[model samples]
Target: MTLVEGAGPRTGAPPEPLRRNREFLLLWSGASMSFLATRVTAVAYPLIVLWHTGSPLAMSVVSTAALLPLLLVQLPAGALVDRWDRRRLMLGCEAGRVLAVGSVALALAAGRVDVAHLAAVAFLESALAVFYRLAERGAVRNLVHPAHLPAALAQNEARGRAAGLLGQPGGVLLHSAARWLPFGFGVLGYLVSLVTLLFVRKDFQAERTAPARPGRLTGEVAEGMRWLWRQRFLRAALGYVAGTNVLFQMLALALILRIKEAGLPSATLAVVVGIGGVGGLGGALAGGRLQRLMSQRTLLIGGAVAWTLLIGAMALTARPVLLGALYAGTGFVGAVFNVAAAVYQVRITPDAFQGRVAATAGLIGSGTNALGSFAGGLLLTAWGALPTVRAIAAAMAVLALLAAVAPGLRGETAATPRTAEPVDPVEPTEKPVEPTEKPVEPTEKGEGDR
Candidate 1:
């Protein structure tokens, strides 16, 4: 659907800002609660498995279960999201997550913790999260005016970083106090998210003339993949993003190894990573302004260069503080790059294709994360932390060079897609309007009053 301004009455007043947009706030806050709860449980899973079973293998299994959905569920989930009612899908996901996580809490309270049960919960929770996230991504552009899309997504990025900053530590602290505390908090968070979602009144997807015809699931997934593959710039940019994602995964492991090799306390590792989270949060907060100032090409290439430099700097320092500083720089660049790319993708993709396209891109970009972590382990085992980090840095340099010369990237722009369907005008309301034609241009208020 087209991104249009809210049509207000002939008062010539400015449109309602995001803070006052009741529907957007409900969606955002509800999503934030769900995401934070997921993060907290992410940390607790391994901790609970290892503490009870005393089996690193069991912990690995649980962790792998959590990650497996990224590979197996994303494509199908995307297709399903496009076919189903997005708000209903999200509500179901939240409900599923609550029951899954709550079961774990209840089991723990009963002094029963089984590896198989934990793995099932982790897998189910992660899979549900995939559906929720895909639906949310498609819903955001529909809820806010086009002019505020970048800002809204920036806020989303910041929320994710902040969750990362607090979730792990919060999980650890909560688990220390009680085995079931983390999951209990997760239950509460999901309940709150569920309640908020119930209050959201806007439609999650653009209005369709008719229901989409049912098709083979694989065919639907392929349709999305083909559509994304046709976008030349997005195709090439996703390649760059995938490469960096792999390297960043390696870098994360390298940092932990470096701290251990330096005989530093575990607390040092936490501090270093936490500092990186702060950097990401800062970058996310600034992303909207950065998008306004820089073109997509500039942001992507510049971010690659910045990451390369930071990785190189990280290789030279064994000091905890120095490593933290360098890692933070990479986080900052990565966050800015993510915000720019997400805004561009959301703007260019059609409302109908949003879920599939986003899922396709996510699958390509993050599918190798596990491989990177595994490779990092092997590299650290064979070459040690410093050598492995130096190698990663050199590889990042190659990606940076590729970004500079990539033809698709060179031709990228910030303009709206020419082929997007026009949105029908509606009367304006005090709340944000539905999107309309000319996705970037601001129009009169009262455009969304159905």
Candidate 2:
């Protein structure tokens, strides 16, 4: 077990089973609903634009608009969250998204919608969602006991994958009924999430006090970056994650093209994508066991290797069944990697640095993926999908190697109080009641995210 200095009772005993906590249950329920809404919005924006303009350029613009917020707002939003009460920040964000998306739903239902209007709403809604997610991530540690952190994070990730599966296709189906239906569904989900938050009673209490003299927000963010970068392990891990994400997007692009190239029907493609949700579910369930048995660094390397092999195999075989098999494996690896990374970060980060550190890493990571896709799009236009996919697969193999053999990065492990000082997690642990019990659960630890 990782030894923490001044361990608090809240951090010592195996965290109470997450599901047993009423406040956590309410929060989880709300998160699930909001995640589902995001998925629906993802599908609705593109489909609605395509239907209206029949202009591929118009569709592309909507995608660009939706993604801009993450690249621009994450660090500032994270800093702001740190300066305010996390729950209120989350609630306000949810309320804002609800109104932004609700306006679109009303406009569409009233026969007054247009592509420009839909894209503008999408931008505002996505921006609100970015801040909301940052606050939620920052507040998570306050909800569950320290020992239960892995399971709680795993469950959250599972809901995210579940939302993607249950919501996106469902959105498309509803859109068939009426283009406006999906937006209405998203608005309703946000409102439900807001109501759930209203009923939940939990506090995200931080012990850190801001400086008497205010520090520059940019300077604080830079401090987070400097600390992360100085730690060789963190730098390599971040690089590997960002590279893996780009490769994963490329693989996704390749699989779609390969399926179509093989003359598979749309239903077959849908089924393949839907089946990935099962793999995500399995990965989430397996995270607890994996953390105990595998080093965080090893988990990341192995997951990256697994994904690379699966994508490479798909590139070689273009058969629909082969593609599905590879996709399921890729999804499984991706989920496990995300779970391990997130928990690991929670274990390492000082509570004071949580919001800024998490957001800086998140924003940069997201930007890398976006940049990768943009590059891939250019590659596709110049050389087409197959070559670009093969190159992407090869690049992943190199990144996986970097994660495994990178020097100065081998010591990455769960945080020990010796390393992450000043900001303590959980209240201090009481003196041991009995020697026979370990107090801390060995099977559950290290939940990090990508």
Candidate 1: worst-modelled 10 consecutive residues by lDDT: 424-433
Global local distance difference test of model 2:
0.72
Lowest lDDT block of 10, candidate 2 = 427-436
Candidate of highest lDDT: 1
How does each model score on TM-score?
A: 0.90, 0.87
Model 1, span 9-75: residue lDDT tens: 2344465677778998999998898899999999999999999889999999999999999999999
Error of 1 at 337 (Å): 0.9
What lDDT score goes with residue 433 in model 2?
A: 16
Please give the CA lDDT of all the candidate structures: 0.81, 0.72
Put down candidate 2 lDDT per residue, 1-450, tens digits, no spaces: 232211235334433456677788888899899999999988899888888779899999998899888888888777776666778887897888888888888888888757788788888888888877877776677776665566677787888888888888899999999978998889889988999889878776455545412667887676666656665666678877787777766666666666776787877777778676778777876765565567777777778678777777766776656666678888887777777677777656666567776887888689778777777777777877678777887888888788778874586644432111234433222211122223333332233321
